[model samples]
Target: MSEKDQEVKDQELEEEVAELKDLEEQESVTDELTELTTKIDELDDQLLRARAEIANITNRNRNERELLQRYRSQDLAKKLLPAIDNLERAMATEVTDDQGMNLKKGVEMTLASLQQALKEEGIEEIPAAGETFDPNFHQGVQTVEASDDVPANTIVQVLQKGYKLHDRVLRPSMVVVAQ
Candidate 1:
């Protein structure tokens, strides 16, 4: 071959190599772009999951707080009910002297006022006197000999009253029951 033809062939080979290199670089750029897009999609999915988890936790906490608020007064109300009962019993006593009667009447009024206040606050006495003795509501203190009128396990007297907090018995009534 002539030198001129050989030079032309060399130039043609160099041009082909350059074109191939450029195509390789373009393919690498495309691959990099695809990898970056995949990473972005993963991050978006993670962010969505995180937000949903936080929302679920927040809602759970709010529900717990509401439940606490609704039942928080139960313990306090149970503690205050006994004093109210004592006051009511004191006021109902019979007095012979004028001074004693006046004092009894005053005490009775105070007890009635306390009971009314307790009613307003959802505090109430359990009815136990002369009822059938129940271990769930009343604690039998002493067994009295049953007369013909009263059956065995009948509540002869309530020594101390029982109380309820809503539907639950807070304190069982202390009673003397018929044998």
Candidate 2:
């Protein structure tokens, strides 16, 4: 080939090389943009999950606080049970004089009022006597031979009254079981 023809060929080859380089640079830029977009989406998803977790934790804590407040009177009502038992025992006693009878009446009214207050506060007596004995609500202090009238594991007598605060037992009834 002639010198001019060779020069023209060289110039064509150089232009093609420059075009290839431009295409490679554009592809590299597009790949970098795609990677950055993916990273942004992943970060946004993580932020949403963290916000949901925070909301759940806040709701759980609020429910716990409400439950605590609802049962706030449980301890005080439990402490007053012994005093109620004493009043009940006093009412059971026989009185001859007018003053003694009046005192007994007062005791009865006081006991009634105390029971009402406890009931309002969600404190209640656990049933024991004449019912089937349950370990959850009744504590068997003594066991007697099973009789035809009372089946095995039946509560024969309640030695001490049991009480509960709502569904939770505060004290188990001390009782005698037929077994």
Candidate 3:
């Protein structure tokens, strides 16, 4: 081969090699960029999921707190039910003498005050007399034959009064049902 021809061939080969190196570098950079973009998308999705979970937890806690606040007096009201029942029983008793009458009056006043306090605290008696029998509010201890005046599943009598604190039943009414 002539010297000039050999030199020209060598220069051309070096240029091709440089072009290949540049192509490889460009391909590597593109692959690296794609990988970085995919990683960023994955991290963004994870961040969104974490935020949603935190929001759900916050809402659940708020609802629980509201329920706790609304029913705060439930326990104390339930405890006072039996005492109110006793007072109601006292009110129902017959008194013949003046002293007995005075005692009865005092009992009546005491019962009234307790009932007022309960009303103020969102506690009230369940109305069972003459109403339809309900297992949710009235517990039928005994059932009587249905009469023409009273239909089946109707409450015949309330043996003991039931009370409730707000929407929750503190106690179910003990009742006789016509069946």
Q: Pick the candidate with the highest TM-score.
A: 3
Q: What is the lDDT of residue 92 in candidate 1?
A: 64
Our tally of clashes for model 1 stands at 0
Candidate 1 lDDT, 61-150, residue by residue in tens: 999997676555668777776677677667667779999988987887887787676666555677888898888889998989998999
Better of 2 and 3 by lDDT: 3
List the candidate 1 regions with Cα displacement exceeding 4 Å: 1-35, 126-159, 174-179
Distance from true location, Cα of 18 in model 3, Å: 1.4
Evaluate residue 144 in candidate 3 and report its C-alpha lDDT on the 0 to 100 scale.
Answer: 94
Q: Which parts of model 2 have CA positions greater than 4 angstroms off?
A: none
Ranking by lDDT: 3, 2, 1
Report clash pairs, candidate 2: none
lDDT of 3: 0.94
Give candidate 2's error at residue 32 in angstroms.
2.7
| Clashing pairs in model 1, backbone N/Cα/C closer than 3 A | none
Q: Which candidate ranks first by lDDT, i.e. highest? A: 3
Compute the lDDT of residue 166 as modeled in candidate 2.
88
